[model samples]
Target chain A: MSRKFNFCAGPAALPEAVLKQARDEMLDWQGKGLSVMEMSHRSDEFVSIANKAEADLRDLLKIPANYKVLFMQGGASSQFAMVPLNLGGKGGTANYINTGIWGKKAIQEAERYMPVHLAGSSAEVNGLSRVPRQFEIQTSTDAAYLHYTSNETIGGLEFDYLPTSDVPLVCDMSSDILSVPTDINQFGLIYAGAQKNIGPAGLTLVIVRDDLLDQAKAEIPTMFSYKVCAENASMYNTPPTFALYLSGLVFDWLKNDVGGLEKMADINQRKAAKLYAAIDANDFYSNPVALENRSIMNVPFRLADASLDKLFLAKADDAGLLNLAGHRSVGGMRASIYNAVPEAAVDALIEFMNDFAKTRG
Target chain B: MSRKFNFCAGPAALPEAVLKQARDEMLDWQGKGLSVMEMSHRSDEFVSIANKAEADLRDLLKIPANYKVLFMQGGASSQFAMVPLNLGGKGGTANYINTGIWGKKAIQEAERYMPVHLAGSSAEVNGLSRVPRQFEIQTSTDAAYLHYTSNETIGGLEFDYLPTSDVPLVCDMSSDILSVPTDINQFGLIYAGAQKNIGPAGLTLVIVRDDLLDQAKAEIPTMFSYKVCAENASMYNTPPTFALYLSGLVFDWLKNDVGGLEKMADINQRKAAKLYAAIDANDFYSNPVALENRSIMNVPFRLADASLDKLFLAKADDAGLLNLAGHRSVGGMRASIYNAVPEAAVDALIEFMNDFAKTRG
Candidate 1:
């Protein structure tokens, strides 16, 4: 079967090699006589799989020894509530930096559990073109923790620099985790829905510092408590076994095949640079986000002739570049070039865009 | 590659046909040039897959038009909190019937949200050998709802009859949901974790009556709200798209390959009966649960001599009968013959058990 360059945001494209390996092992995992999906979560076979996935991820991220990496379900949306429920019990208001749709949603969900203070925001800037600078952010006097979206998936806005906070730093890195190396010790908790840079939907990757685990509200649901999940090694219940297994394959691909996050970041920068260069060179296309804040993972652009938008997407699909349409809330074009997306895929997209601009500009 | 019998309780065996189909389509689903895992949840392709799976499940269970089916994440453990958070907002004590481990866990989670009254309990019966009869279940004076585990995976106990109440009746049918046909009209809501009888570990299936959707507590997390989920058609956020796709294939297999639940139920009864008869005839093996209460899907047994337990498990593994060891909490042998576990697998297991008894008795 022919593979296409898929650019859909969240539940996005997986690495072709990982999918091939998964396919080969679907019926009988390592001659275990059963699919990974069929194994008991408590079984030695599955526990090893779970541990290896976490270990490989830790190695890739160079995560500190004291942090617990939890393989959970319910996506990053669940973490919006979980973050506040787990961290907001310290009798202080939580601070949030509103940058885009995802950041706003996280604030709205957190408001249900604790008092939320908007310490920093991009709303003052037209169209959320950039993020609030680190110096501009103001942590609340009684801030339990400071939370922000590392990269806004839909808006294609990203923080070029990390924001500092006196309270522990928490981030919703749903779209950008593992795309670059980071100092895990700088954050209290960081979570990403696996659908984007990691593996598939259903599996959420949560990395939280050991010290922050015990601060959960007493009234929080047991399942919502990060400490419980950490204590159980993320098997407080049956985790998405197949999803975890597939993600483990992805972690392996990242480490061995792509040569870790440094190499991945280099490739990502080059890929995004080429695409952005193509956009800037053409009068037919224009990107809205400021140069400094442009996300390396997601690039959103508009055709100069709005009438040609439908034709552009149609031609791109015909050229085997699928899911180029932007999110419904923001109607334009967004190419989410996650770690799985190869530079060749970006090359093909650029070639197609150039041809489309030449023929239809 | 040779396939063997796998009897994992949850995250259990799936139909061989379903696995083969999944393997074949892992890279390119329906010539769509992308894996089901790679597709956007909001795309037409994945949406159709989700819709068809829900439709097929509704058809299999004969679910009425008044119910909304939700494909959620975080398993039944998450549901333990969600059930109370969603149903306990009406300001009445929630009544729970405690029969086995799963039921007790459900009650414990509910107690964190609101006042929970134990309507009926099998603790008095000793070792949870039987379920409380309908007449024994006494709903509270101001009962919000009656909740029970229809099939306890760990204890191998199942409710032979429905528990009736004036308020909404909720059931966690995690293990035995698709094994037998039932009247969906009897319960206000029924939920299942897909790993057992449905598909995989990452997806949770919820069927809630339309009228009960609005009862969620205001303080509940948005991700925990059944009303919001139903309104968004279970896509308030990115769903576990690949898991949902695989489950749809399973539903299709259940409908087309095995016929409807009537035929499946007949086969399931026969499979359980033969295994139970084998256990009864051999003095070496003893099933603890009452005959009527014994679970059709999960058959838990113990060795006459406790020392033989390890040896029995070893031989079972050597003979290609895998995962026969019981839950760690109970510490015996459990053969979870889910709907996907073929009758031939059961026959092989019986032969192995009979031979083991004769040689070592």
Candidate 2:
């Protein structure tokens, strides 16, 4: 049977090739007579796998020499708390740009540790637009860092440019990472949950400048300490071994098969354009976000007639286009087109959407 | 090629049947047309899978209605910090029993949050034995909880009985959680990392008394809050979906094919006995732990002639036995016979040990 295109936000779609390789190697990996999942993290075989995963990810993102790559657990949400606990030492405050749900969550978590400054926000615009130029950024010369969500999944909004700041720039790039290329050197720390564009849900990838690692609050847990995780190569405890292995396969797939992030950016641009064009071609559907600052990864649109929402979802499911329902916060539909989503899948979804619209209209 | 028996401590062996089922369903789970890994956590299909996994685990352990089961991340080590942060609210002390590496780590982490009372300890015995009855278990009537490592994985030590206390009992059951039948009602909280006796390495299982859920410090991250995790059904963030799904398969294997935990306890007892008998039969190899309190899961032994250690490992590898090397802290050989270890494997290991000893002698 043909595979379905999964549009899940996270625990999201992975490259079929990676899944196939994992399935084939589930019994015996590299003639070791044991599955990768079963190998001890201390084993030579697993050590090699873990090291390669980190090295390949660094290469793909062009990570600078001063940054340490850490494979952590508990997803991006966990990092929201960890970033503050590690960076917001003593009574230091940090600046946060609130864009949408993820940004607000990060700000809320950061508030638990120290005073958080809301630098800029698109929340007043319902997160449908980018932060306006007239908006003021509350920067503290003595602040710990500036935090922002590069991509907001639930609200289908994204920041195209990095926040201009002298302070270390920290970002939650959970939804948009690896889908497009970015300047890794500009950020002091960047973290992304693996589900959307990496591999699966359990693993979180953290890249932090080495200079920023030494100042964790004295009371923070060792597991939450960036210094401890970096010192032990993220094996301070038994890491998500299987998740790391799977993510390594994805990194290899992205580099060799999917043609790296440069090519991925090109292809993603095309896919997003096609879907957006289809939505904008007629008045049958509407995307509320401003066209200039629209997100290329997530496109949330609504039917012209609200009554057809259920009908659209049912027909889409029948056609094997799944997880098209938008997050409850927004009522219509959402199509998450991460890096693993092929152009053909988006084309099929557009075709299906057009056909359904024509018949219903 | 035939499969070999693996003895790695964590990210260790899983049931062959579970691995097979996981591979079979990797691309499409139960005709869902999407891999379980790709499904959204909020999807009905995955929600049902998560609910069933929790229900089955509760049934296996006979969990009381007052307890809540939560699937979390960051392994047992993260829980080390989270437990104290949640329970030790506003400057309260908790009692800790130090038996081995895991216990020591727990103490070090807990000290970051609140005062930790060194109640009972066998670390002075080089972790070769469990805590003696004469050891004082200091407890203040106002103590937050009593924490202990039920089975020390690195030190190969196990607690024979619970400490007498009216305070809440919290256990890090990472290494030997389901190896035998457990009285779940006795403990306020029991947490296990799913690597040794469970499924994979990413997911952590926390069984907390419902009444203890509201005790999380408001400053704690929402992801680490027991109340938040319980309210969202462990899907507060995207859970380790693939890990949880595989763990569900393991729960089924344990309950159905393995004749439940009672039968598993008997089989595990027999497996440990066979290996221990070999060590006892001759003076060539010796296990330092006392017999009555020996762990049924991990058995660390050493040769009388230290020079033969490498030779023994090479010969064992040639015989398709792997990961017999002990942790670096202790220099010896360890054979961890967790629940997935079949009787035939134990018999083969015994035969190999006898032959090696006879030849060397």
Candidate 3:
């Protein structure tokens, strides 16, 4: 069956190869006579699946040995609360760089746990069009850590360069983790909800430096504590076994098909440019994000005539481009061309956008 | 392909119909051109799926209007912390009934939040055989609530009758929730992790009484707050969407195939009785739990000779009676015949047990 070009922001498009692989193995994983979904987490088969997923992910990004890759849940949102609870030690404050809604969410949740230093925020810049420039970043003295969102899925903005910090720099890379290359050593911790670049919605990937594990609060809930997660290798409880198995398939696809994150970023850059170029060709479509900080993973735009937005979406859906409706917070069109979205899909979207503008304009 | 009898404790077996449906719809759900895994949670398609799942569950259980059903994560283990953080009203002690490992875990986590009254515990009765009788319960004058595990997975103990409490009664029905029918109005709250009888791992089902939500502390994390979850209709952030979808399919299976909880419970009862009878009929096998407390979900038993336990499990697995190993905490064997396990599987297990015991004894 022909598949549509799905541009969902999250719980988003997975590689066709990965999806097909998962489907083929759904009833009985490699003749084990049970779906990975039904496999016991403690079973040798699932344990190996979990291990390979982590190892392959580690290899994909050249993650350092000191960083423990954890498969967790509650997504990056939960980490917003967990970071402060785990890292916000006694008599210490954590600095937050608020780039967009995700960053603000982390900062707000952190406030409930510790002294939050809203060191820098893009709100002052208006419309959240761009990330805070290097010189604009401000942090407090003796801050426990600095937290920021690497990619804002909603605002369609992202940091081009990793922010420098004397203290540990933690990143919420939920939307763009494997879409681009990253140096694991630069950040003390990084977390991503496994929906966009990864496989499914239930799994969350956390890469935490070993040194920070000991700083977790004594009273933090066992499930939320990085110390416990690291100690148990994220198997403290029954994990999302099926999702983890699918994620390993995604990693395998990334490694064997796309080569690696460096090549992945190059392909992603090309895909984003194709959509941006089509938008730039006509004033009928307008993007609010700054050219310098626009997200390659999520490209949100607006129709020249607000009334035509529904028509555009309907036409797009009819033409097989899906979930292109932007976040309700940001009205108009949002084409989330995540890693799994082939360049062919973007080409199809670009063609549709040009035709859409011509008809509406 | 014929499926094996998967006896995993959690992340356990799923209904064959549900698995087949998921497999068929893995690539495209209802011709939406995107798998449920890929559909945006906020989209109309996914929302309908989530809403219908809750509605079906409510219909099956007869949950009152005063209850809010929340699809959450971090499993039932996270609920241990959330119960105290949300229901442990400020300065008030909560009564806890310690039945087994799960109950003790809840009590331990609750201790970190508020003073806990060990209202009753079965520790004095060695091997966690039976729950304390009605006369055994003791609650503090100012206790916030009473928490108990409806079924102990490890020890194979289940409460035949719901415990009465003056204060709110919070039950972790993780292993036994949808397997049996219950009057929802009797309990202030009920929660269950999905892996056992619901669907895949990672999704957690939470039934919170509307009034009990207000008791949550101001300082509780937003993700963990019943107020936030209820207010947002379980979409405060991106939930485990695929898990939620699978759970809906499971609810459908329970309704359409199994008829309802009453019939499901009856079937489960028969399956448990058959296995228990097989054990009791021979001197080669023994179950530690009292007959009244024997769990229909998890049937744990020991071999007459402990040395033969490994051989028993090996031969059982060889015969496709898979994952029959007991919890590490409790040795011997545990055949967790959750709702998904058919009567035929239990019959197969009982038949295998008799033949193996005859040969060994």
Candidate 4:
């Protein structure tokens, strides 16, 4: 069967190679006589799969030994509450930099548990189009941790510079995690939902400093406690085994097929550049984000005429380019060219975009 | 490739037909040109898969209109905390009947949120071998709700009867949810991890009465709120799309292939009965669990000569009977005959058991 290009924003595309490998091994994982999904989490075969995935991830990111990698469930939204419940238990206000919808969500969830200080905000500049600069961030003296969304998937805003604070730095890196090289040592905690750049939707990847593990509130649920999860190697409960197995295949793809994150970033930059250049070349399409702060992962653009929006999406679907619609909250077009999205898909999308603009402009 | 009989407690054996379908559709789901894992939970294609799965599950269980089925992440372990946090807002002591390891863990987690009164326990009878009778249970005068483990996976204990209570009833049916039909109107809420009898490990199924949805504590996380999840149709976030898809397939298998739970129970009962009879017939092998309270899902038996345990497991493995070893907490041999484990597998296990006893006894 022929495949189509998918650009779903969150539960987005996965590498074709990874999906192929998973398909081949779905019935009997490595000749083990049963599918990986059918194996116990504590089984020797699954443990090896789990360990290798974590190792490949550490190698790709150059993650510090002092950091613990947690393969968790409940997505990044769970981490929104976990970040505060774990870090804000000591009676300190959480410092947050509100960049877009995702960052605002983290702030809102954190506010449920403790007092929150708005260290910075994208609204101070040009609404959701631009990310707040590092210098604009103001941390409270009693800050528990400074939290921000590294890339907002919906609004297409990204941080060009990492904000520093005396408090621990926490980030929600859901949309842009494996698309680039990241310094794991710079953050106290970093979490990403696996659907976008990692693997699938159910599994969540958490990289947190070991020291921060014990900072959870006394009332923390055992499942949400990083220390408990880390201690049990994220097997406090039956992990999403199939999701973890698929994610391991993704980690393998990232390391071997894609040649690591540096190569990934180069390809991502080129793809984003060509697409943005096409958008800016004609008045038929326009993207409002600042050039320096634009997100390479999620590129949101609007047609010169609002009436062509439905037609553009329908034609895109006809051309086998799928899920290009923007967030429901904001009506437009968005192309989430994640790491797994081949550059060929981007080229095809750009070609389709130019053709659509010429004929329908 | 040949398939082997897997007796793992969980993530246990899945129907070969289910795994085959999953393998066949891994890359291109229903000719949609992308894996179910890649499709957005909000996409029409994915939504159709989700809705059909829910409908099939409701049909299989004969769920009532007053109950809302929530497809959530974080497994049954997360429900250990959620049950208390959601239902204990008014501050009455939560009544629990502890039977085995899973039940004890649930009680410990519940204690962190509210006062817990042990209404009854298996230890009161003998140990974990016999379930505490309904008449023996003594609910507290200030009981907010009564919680019980319908079937404890670890100890091979299945409750013989449902305990009656004036307060709301909450049941953790993690191990025996879909094995047999039951009256859903008897309980306030029922939650189960999907790995054992449902589908896989990542998804948790919650069927909560609509009236109980609004009783959550104000401090509950949005992800943990039944009201919020039901309102969003369990799409408050991504909601584990692939796991949900796979679970739907399992429901399809139950309804279409197995001809509903009555047929499934017929097969499961025969499988368990034959295995337990073999153990009872021979002095070389024995199971401590009571006859009436024995779990039809997991059957744990031990050799009279404990020294032969390792050899028996090895010989069973060599014969393609895999994962015969019991849980690490309790050392023995366990043959989990969940719905997916064919009757042929049990015949093979019995043959192997008798052969081993003849030679090694």
Candidate 5:
């Protein structure tokens, strides 16, 4: 049976094939008579699973040897605290580019550990655009790192290009990590919470450069220290075993079933374009973000007739298009077309939007 | 088909019924056509699932209305840092009773936040016994809280009674929670990583008194703040949904199949007694912990002739007894009899031990 298209901002849809494979393996994982959740993290069986998952993820992203991939817990929110706690050595200053809600959160968290300088901000533009080209980035020679949210799930804003700076770049790719291809070597660190495009909610994937690993403050707890996690293979403690298992399945699915990141990028772009075209086709609906900076994974749009917002949602829900409601901050509708969201689902959503627009217009 | 009796220490065993229910619900949950993993955490459907799980937990534990139960991410290791970050307000000192590896780690983490006084320790005794009665606990009037490890999985040690102090008692009950009955009111705070007796690895359960809520440092991330997690109903961010669902099933199984905590406690006592007796009856096997303070959940025993240890483990693995290897720090065997470990499994292990001991002797 076909599944309804889910446009949840996060804890979002996973590939049906991946889910089916997981379901089939839920009872007995490779004839081990144990679900992956029940196995000891240190056991040979789990070690191989964890190792293969990391290897496959490395291959999918083409991560550099200098970057260590750590599977952690507590999501990106935890990393909001951890990034500064570790990277802000000696409580120095750092650069923050605020594009939206996630960037603001990252800055708020970094403030506790160091002086966070606002390098660039789009919030002044009413949270609908990217970092302005003319905004000056005041980079101190001693600044620990320059941090930004690559894609804002709530604001539906994304950075079209990385800011050019001498300082190390750290990006929170929580909402849009593997949806498209990018230069992995440019950033000192990149962290993504896996609930959106990856697999499950509990696991956070961190890719950190080797040089930054040992820069954590001595006062930081071992669990939060990037060096400790990297050294121990993110098993400094019992990780979210099931989440990691699902993430491994997702990585494998991306490599084999989805035809790797290049294909996924193309498919995701098509999905976003189809939905965005429906919004731009008539004055009845509008997407405020600039075309060049619009997110390929999340498309936030609104009806011209404000009174029709609730009606549109009700009709969409009735038609089995769920969680299309936008963030309250944005006050519109958002369709998060992540890797797991099939092209057909996006086509269906576009059809529904067009049909709804005809009556509303 | 009947399942094998698994004796893994953690990420250990879960109720077969719970696993079966999870398997059955893997594809479509209650006709939702979405697996629990695929459900948005913020969706009304998943919200209800999370709420019911919390309510069931509170009901099973008979937690007071004044206490808040938080289903958090990051295992107990994260709690080691978070407890200090939240409770160790304004550089206040706290007392930590070091019983085993977990306690030592907690102390190390807490020391980063404030001056942690070592109220008592069992490490000098090789982590075999609980905190010594002769040890004096120096509680400062300004201390934040007193901490202890209720049960140490690595070293088969457990507290026999509560420490006599007016300070708020905090216990890391990671290994022993839900295996027996206890007074929930006695603890000002209790946190357990869910891999052992609760449900899965990703979720950590924290029970804290309401009065302790406002004591956290304001600088801590909102996600790590016990106050924020409680206020948001543990929905501050996307939680481990599938983990929470499985945990709810385990809670139900605990209520019905295991005859609740009271009955489980009695059965656990009997099971521990039977196994300990077998080890003590024959000098070929020995448990180092003082008999009165030994853990009923984790029984770490060693052969009198150490040369036969490898042989014993090899034979045990062939017989489907896995993860019986002792922690590297403590060179022996550990049989973790969690809630899911049936008495029959303990009997089988004892039978195997006897058969092996005869030949070694």
Candidate 6:
């Protein structure tokens, strides 16, 4: 009857404070007397909302001044094609590290417009449970850019460190962008769908270095053009105004309530540790990902007997741990603990897992 | 202060009851314990919401059974490129009528992928104040489709009836859909950005006849392909879930409170007539659009003395007739009386206009 510990991968959990704030302002945002969705995107009030969201995001990530923050639509899947169309011109070669589903998907889209070279792959590891070390694969010298997915939502494998490479680093940090801090200057470009840690579905955050704007292919669709969006401040057309406004509220919450990315990261680390420890504490549960590469944002594990998965998920749902069923691609259990999934939620999940293993072992 | 009479063109106004419903349910939609934005687009809850939205939309318009309603993104501008890419094929010709800004935009984007024939244009009618009558334009039988904008928001020009032609009709109804009744079988495809009469910005509603799905070119990006979106049930990617949900609420509001499209159209007609009569009451105020082609949704008018425009807009804003400043390209005043702008708002605007004209004269 009350709120549940929602573990849906995405659109995943959102901060309760943010949701409450949004609810309070749903009809009249900032005393404007109209819902934020009704306000024109070009109006001063909505403009302030959009500007603040981008500013707070820049501060939270310490994004470099030379980079442009574009609040776009169409999600990260659109970025899969956009990155290739914008960065890798026709006949150009782009190197992609095939570590998991997200990476493979990016590679597949890129190959449609350009030749993609496999810079590295961890597929040899069972179930793609690890990332290939830096020295394990050769990087192409003339790559348009080196692309990699930082955290694979389904595979529960994450890269602990930036891949060492000479080419420009393009990262699909869809699942782990704000959960951790990174040197923004190191990335040529980074993109993530807003459903994970940003705000909601439909909006995508694209941060691209200034110099990379000129590399876009001439014939690409205007909406998918990063350079054009950067030039026009992402208002080339009517944007997802409400989604952008909500994300701004989230950025504000992360700053005033949670402090900043460093504090949020500490909280995330602790939450992931509690859940992973519960799994490793007994032989009754197992997570196939290598210890170093296990995702802190998404903790996927399985009962010793696959037959118990249905029972595990059904009971978890009854206990208010909703959407715990793993992806159909990797059927077991995946408890996605994004920034909004409070540490208490993870503790509740761990407690439930422990009790279940004890009762059914 | 209570809610203002917001007259913004695209992200215009929403029904008060719909906004109130959204506010009341923002935090716990149907007792789900989370904001709609946090629910996965693929979740059964969201899927139901999406399905019901399309169904209600179909019911309102009496969409032919051969049409597939797709909830998409990128707005109408994206559809500009998608139209040519999907229907006209490479180097093929498509007939486009140049009415005003929106038409020119669609033509520009279409020309990138196909040759566009200008069927007829009102540009010669001083400031594009009219639409070329059906007899004035010649339709191309060899063309893939004939494209036109049902209403030009900025220009305040609207087609009084369907364009007579054998070619399949494709219309950009971004500014005026659901405000009136339409014969769905007359068009092969119709697309509208949801910011106007539907819900909010970002989400685009596409109604495409099922038989046209196979014409999409293979080279277009996945998100732009209507065929792919139709096949995936518009879950081709995480949609603008919040916008879609809000639009569904709007549809429900229309069905239960406003009755149906015919009733809504009657109210809209009365509101437009009241405002137009006020403009024509004296020589001091004048509407630029031809009477027969004037849009019921957007009315653009100019003062007899252009010098009074600024004071007029300022006074109107102070009186809470917001966004009355006409588009820059067509400097004057615009009052977009969308479905959500109740008759009271129109009366307020008309009363204000008459008083202003009398005082200035």
Q: Which predicted model would earn the best lDDT? A: 1
**Interface RMSD, one decimal, each candidate:** 0.7, 1.1, 1.1, 0.8, 1.9, 1.4
Candidate 6: which stretches are off by over 4 Å? A124-128, B123-128
DockQ of 6: 0.71
Residue B126 of model 1 has an lDDT of 54
Q: How many residue pairs clash in each candidate?
A: 0, 0, 0, 0, 0, 0
TM-score of each predicted structure versus truth: 0.99, 0.97, 0.98, 0.99, 0.96, 0.98
The residue pairs in collision within model 5 are: none
DockQ comparison, 3 vs 4, better candidate: 4
Docking class of 5: medium
The global Cα lDDT (0 to 1) of model 6 is 0.88
> Which stretches of model 2 miss by more than 4 angstroms?
A123-128, A134-138, B123-128, B134-136
- Which 10 successive residues of model 4 chain B have the least lDDT summed? B123-132
| CAPRI grade of model 1 | high
Candidate 2 lDDT, B1-361, residue by residue in tens: 4688887777888899999999998888888888999998888999999888888888888888889899999899989989987887655788888888899999988887888888888734553475645347777656889898888887778878766678889999999999888888889889999999888999999999998887776667778888899988787888999999989988989999997999999999999988999999989989888766688899889999989999999999889888889987898999888988788878888899999999994
Q: Order of candidates by DockQ, top first?
A: 1, 4, 2, 3, 6, 5
DockQ of each: 0.88, 0.77, 0.76, 0.86, 0.59, 0.71
What is the alpha-carbon lDDT of model 1 when measured against the actual structure? 0.92
Q: lDDT of all predictions, in order shown?
A: 0.92, 0.87, 0.89, 0.91, 0.85, 0.88
How far does residue B243 in candidate 4 sit from its true spot (Å)?
Answer: 0.6
TM-score of chain B of each: 0.98, 0.96, 0.98, 0.98, 0.96, 0.97
Candidate number with the higher TM-score (4 or 5): 4
Which stretches of model 5 miss by more than 4 angstroms? A123-128, A134-142, B90-92, B123-130, B134-142
**Model 6 agreement with the true structure over B270-343: per-residue lDDT tens digits:** 99998999888878888888788999999988889999989998999889888988887778889999999999
What is model 3's DockQ versus the real complex?
A: 0.76
Local accuracy of candidate 4 as per-residue lDDT tens digits, A54-162? 9999999999999999999999999999999998777899999998888888889999999999999885345336777778888998999999999989888888888
- The TM-score that candidate 6 achieves is 0.98
Per-residue C-alpha lDDT of model 1 across residues A1-361, encoded as one tens digit per residue: 9999998887889999999999999999998999999998888999999889989999999999999999888898999999999997778998999999999999999998899999998744565388888888998899999999999998899899988888899999999999999889889999999999999999999999999998888878888899999999998999999999999999999999999999999999999999999999999989888889999999999998989999999999999999999889999999999999989999999999999999999
Clashes of 2: 0
Model 5's DockQ? 0.59
Model 5 lDDT per residue over B228-313, tens place? 89998898777888899999989989888877889989989999999999999988988888877889999999898888889999
